[model samples]
Target: MSTAFDILVALGGLACAGIALVAGNRIGSVAAFVIMGFFVALAWVRLGAPDVALAEAAIGAGLTGALLLRSANRLGPVREAGVPIAVHGIAACLSLALAGGIVWAFATGTAEAVYPSLVAARVGESGVSNPVTAVLLNFRAWDTLLEVAVLVVALLLVSGLAPVRIAPAPPSELVLPFLRIVVPVAVLLAGHLLWKGATAPGGAFQAAALLTGGGLALALCGLLGAGRRTGHVLVLAGLGGLALFLAAALGAAILTGGLLDYPAGSAKVWIIAIESALTLSIAAMLVSLFLGPSEGVRDDR
Candidate 1:
């Protein structure tokens, strides 16, 4: 059964990718790519990497699909110019060469497993029993910090470019009730994921994505306030996580003589703190990215 499921997932992912590549409609192509992301995420789960699956689902499928749809809407339809056969041939050759290189490297790579064993042996020292969390927050936190920096850069670039305001939905009888119930549930779920990251398959990225979804929901429903000044404030606040993470890293370095080297038994504290701050910052940054750079005018609720 497991083997069959794996085969199905592999086939599904390939089909989706091919469909996306060949689809004439922009929206259709984006939809296929989004489905492919889900299939790829499922494959990650089947490969025993739920964390990767979560990231893929949230960033790859969910947020990326939103961006693509927006871009597609903005672009509308354009007349396509036929590509030369020589150009297509060159592209195909390059792709085949890349695939062959990957296969060759894998076939020649050493079988000796080093990092997994090392990570397992030192999981206790990292203060998180979850190996993935340990590596991300303690064992190699500087790498995670750099990932946040990338998001910050993206936010900066987006702030400069995306200034158009999306008009909020007109007030409806169902909107408030919906927000009242769903928003709280989302908050609880986000918190649950944040707390679970220390010991389970949830973390800051996953939780942040959930919160961003909720924020978008509220914004669309005309319950959340947004403007250029508000966007500026949110962006400023988004740096809070980066600051907290760096402070933790530096504090750890002061105590342990190495960067991100948490002092004995206190790693969990730093991880939780960093993850919490990160959850909020990431959500804020995403919301600002989507609803930001507006004029001084507020959308009518």
Candidate 2:
């Protein structure tokens, strides 16, 4: 059954990916890509990586789909463009070669797995019950730190582009009440996910994505604006994680003699603090990415 399920997921994901690439309309392509993301998440779960599955669902599928849909709506409909038969043939051959190479590499690769055991042996020192969390927040903290920095850089680049805001649609009466309930629930869930991350398959990225989803809902309903002064709040929020993480890194280096090395028995506290800050920052950054440049006027009505 498990093998069959995995096969089904693989096929479904491939089908969706193909549809996404070849769909005649932007909306159709985006929808197909979203479905592909979900299928990929399922594949991750089947591979025994629930943490990856959650991230795939939240960031790869949900947040990315939302961004693509918004971009598609702003750009209007996609027009069909003809491709030269020779170009299409060349592209297909290159794609097949790439796919074949990837398959060969995976099939021939040595299954020497040392990292899992290393993580298990050192997890107690990492101050987190979850092995994945320990690896991300402790053993491989530099990677996570750089990931946050990448998000910060992406936001700066987007801001520099000075993209215009697509005037929001009229606020819907029904959405307001729905958002009131959903937004609070999203906040509560984000908090829970952040807290649970140390022991479970939840983490900053997933929690932040949920929080961003809530913020997007509010913005779409016109209850939030992207004005310059108001956007400063988001800018601060976006920087908070990186700032706090750097401070912690420097403090650790000074006190423990190594960067990101937490003092004995205090690793959990530091990791949790950083994750909390990152959750907020990531959410703010994502929302601001969707909002684009500020309109210089409040529109919370």
Candidate 3:
């Protein structure tokens, strides 16, 4: 009694996985990976998780594919014949064996749902109906907070590598008009997602991804350019979320006697505020990553 959607999802998964394995070149592998991401997104929707699907389609497939393609362009085309046959064989065998073992374990394992009581007990206090949102933003806020820090640090390290130097060139007129319309719309959408995340599936990660996409669109179209200096404002933007969260948490200790202990009256507001800041910081960090050390020509038409 599988629905058509379920059948399509299953077929898509098999197709993507099979293509990934059989692909002989780097380009083919990249293509397969992108398709796999799309299929994964569909699977997420089939499993009744729209937020995960959106994130998968945006960041997992869209941004990841762009990064891979950009890297490949810089590295030049792969020379298949130049690779050693013995090395390829060894790599293939090892990969296949590892994948097989993982599959076997999952197939044989008795799955047990643990920790439901804990989640159910805390759900009401978390200020959200969605259990996943509750766990992500309230129960496990520290993890999410630190993850934002990690993304910021990674961007800073990349920026420090070569200094930012944007090429001086005018982007095509054709690209500008499209960006002008799209960027504002993207910003509005990101804000909406961030706000809705409290009770719904949308959240900081999805908002950040859309915001990142908008920034990237601007950079790609030559509307925004990188320079030698990582301005104090940009640096602050990167650390702002973590700073705000820490400050708020520590400030609450004076009133509540514990760090990160929001006053009972406005816990939801505080969490939402922190998530908004996180969305901004995460978006900026992701955009900076694509911009790299900053010496590159990006033409959009």
Best by lDDT: 2
Per residue, candidate 1 scores C-alpha lDDT tens digits across 16-75 of: 999998899999999999999999999999999998999899978998887788667666
lDDT of each: 0.85, 0.89, 0.77
- Top candidate, metric TM-score: 2
Model 2 lDDT per residue over 150-174, tens place: 9999888877765666567887778
Residue-wise C-alpha lDDT for candidate 3, range 25-70, written one tens digit per residue: 7678778889999999999998888989988998898888877766
Report the CA-based lDDT of candidate 3 relative to the real structure.
0.77
List the candidate 3 regions with Cα displacement exceeding 4 Å.
Answer: 1-4, 18-27, 79-112, 163-169, 229-235, 252-257, 293-301
**Which ranges in model 2 have alpha carbons more than 4 Å from their true place?**
76-90, 296-301
Q: What clash count goes with each model?
A: 0, 0, 0
By lDDT, the candidates rank as 2, 1, 3
Winner by lDDT between candidate 3 and candidate 2? 2
